[model samples]
Target: MADLRVLIVDDDFHVARLHATWVDAVPGFAALAPVGTAALALQAAHSLRPDLVLLDTYLPDTTGLELLRTIDTDAIMLTAASDPESVRTALRRGALGYLIKPFSADDLAAALRGYARYRRVLAGTGSLDQAGLDRARRALLGGADAPSSGGPSRSRSATETAVLEALAQGPGSARALLSAAEVAAVVGVSRATAQRYLAALAEDGAVEIQLRYGSTGRPEHRYGLSA
Candidate 1:
């Protein structure tokens, strides 16, 4: 089979570029375009007709969900919105895979491979047994639980649980989490307190942190659960 064509759409220029690079790095994939707006994305989908789309839930001009409803392409949602409701909405709206942001190259590659396998099965190229489907569903929905490498045994508080749930949706640096603030606000804590909790989780091996650098002054750190 020929390499699958991919279209990446995100309002953030950096994110769009990053996704494009990741897709290009995949052996059986080629990035057709990385667009920064819903309008452009729609146009690309109509014209380029990529095999897959990496979509973001939040956009500058329109909700990613709204754009998704209109597009005819096979889509995989890539978003920082990790809430259950959002995830449910994405899945219900026909997203093949839902990936939270700040994902590692390995995780992204895994998602792509899973989606490719799904496509093959759907196209009647391969038989999808009940067991295989079950396993794929578990992986798609983040149910393939893998234990963390190292972490303290302290029980997670309710607030901590909320924070972890948010992180599970996508990776974020402490600064980014502070900027979003929804999880912290939902859990009824100050931003400073949330940072401390993130630090603790990182220390416990519940989350992993990566240093991100750009043209900006200081390199920022992002966190995500060790999936």
Candidate 2:
């Protein structure tokens, strides 16, 4: 594939710059421009016609979700809101993926790859039948199937389901998973309880845990659906 042009929109200048730097660092992408508001983003999109957009949920002038409705390019939502409803809303609004804030470069890379793959399938560059789409959707949802079954059969509780659903939105460490605390909060539980449920899911092969080490206090453990 050719290099993808990306425009990043975030109210935080630091974040927009950081995302632009990371996207440029990636091999097959060209970070076109980084804007700080929905109005500027729309203007840039119309003028630049970027291949993709990395947009934040909150903007000084308008909500990211609303901006998404008016845009015509492939987009990914980057936000601190990890709630299932928010994630679902973003996806329903035509976003290719939902990325929570504080994501690492590797996380961004993985999402880009997924978007690339999805684009390929949509463009007929890859073969994906109904079964394949179903499997991919299940995998995206972070659901595990039984050994002999062809579909997902849940053995987790409602809390575990909520945690898994949030994790499905993007990759994150246990600490970062707190971004999705609204899931547990909606169920009326503390963040600690939500963490415990995620930990349990990790232990049960319902999720995958990865240790991320950086210039920080302790190595952070991020989780995703077990593949």
Candidate 3:
């Protein structure tokens, strides 16, 4: 298969180059020269005909969605603008994926892999079977087609489900995630009981626990959802 050509569009020179480098590092992807304005992006797309574009929401000349309307190939938006309107517009304008900013390189790689699969499926010769069509559809969405079997998402014993729900929705910062004591209070259980549940959940990829450090005290386990 041929390498997937990607045009990265962002206003910041440093960020654009960083993403360009990351794209080039991926096994089946190559980065085109990035552009800082929507006008340049449109021109690049017209002339270069890249397989995909990594676009930002804001451009010095126009909005990314505006540029999206003119481009013919697939696009995956990578932008800091997390507003509902922008997300909706990107989808409505035919974006293939929406990746929020501050994402890891792994996240971008996953998207690229999914896009590659989608393109491959589309290029297949024969009519697709149910499974083949399903794979193609899931690739565009960039995640598993099914809801997680673990966590608070399924039917289970009443006691177990209630505890999972609490941890799944638990909110905390990087510095201070909800501790076992806090989760215990929320779920009407003892601290030790909450800790046991959290540990189990973490092992199952339902949630994660990290230590929060402070200048004056020892680090403590803080709980957050794996997502």
Per-candidate local distance difference test: 0.69, 0.69, 0.76
Question: For model 3, how does the per-residue alpha-carbon lDDT over 32-58 read when each residue is reduced to its tens digit?
Answer: 989999889888999999999999998
Q: What is the C-alpha RMSD of each candidate to the true structure, in Å?
A: 14.8, 14.2, 13.3
Q: Cα lDDT for residue 58, model 1?
A: 85
User: Residue 94 of model 2: what lDDT?
Assistant: 92
Better of 2 and 3 by lDDT: 3
TM-score between candidate 1 and the true structure:
0.57
lDDT of 1 by residue, 1-227 (tens): 56689998898988788877777655456787698889899989999899999999888889888887999988998899999998888888888888887798778866775565454335555777887677556644433311211345666777678888776554354333322244466557776456545545654577665655669643444556665
Rank by lDDT (best first): 3, 1, 2
Q: Scored by Cα lDDT, where does model 3 land? A: 0.76
Residue 61 of model 2 has an lDDT of: 97
- Residue 154, candidate 1: how far off, in angstroms? 39
**Model 1 poorest ten-residue lDDT run:** 141-150
TM for candidate 2 is 0.57
What TM-score does each of the candidates earn?
0.57, 0.57, 0.61
Task: Report residue 133 deviation for candidate 2 (angstroms).
Answer: 4.3
The collision pairs in model 3 are none
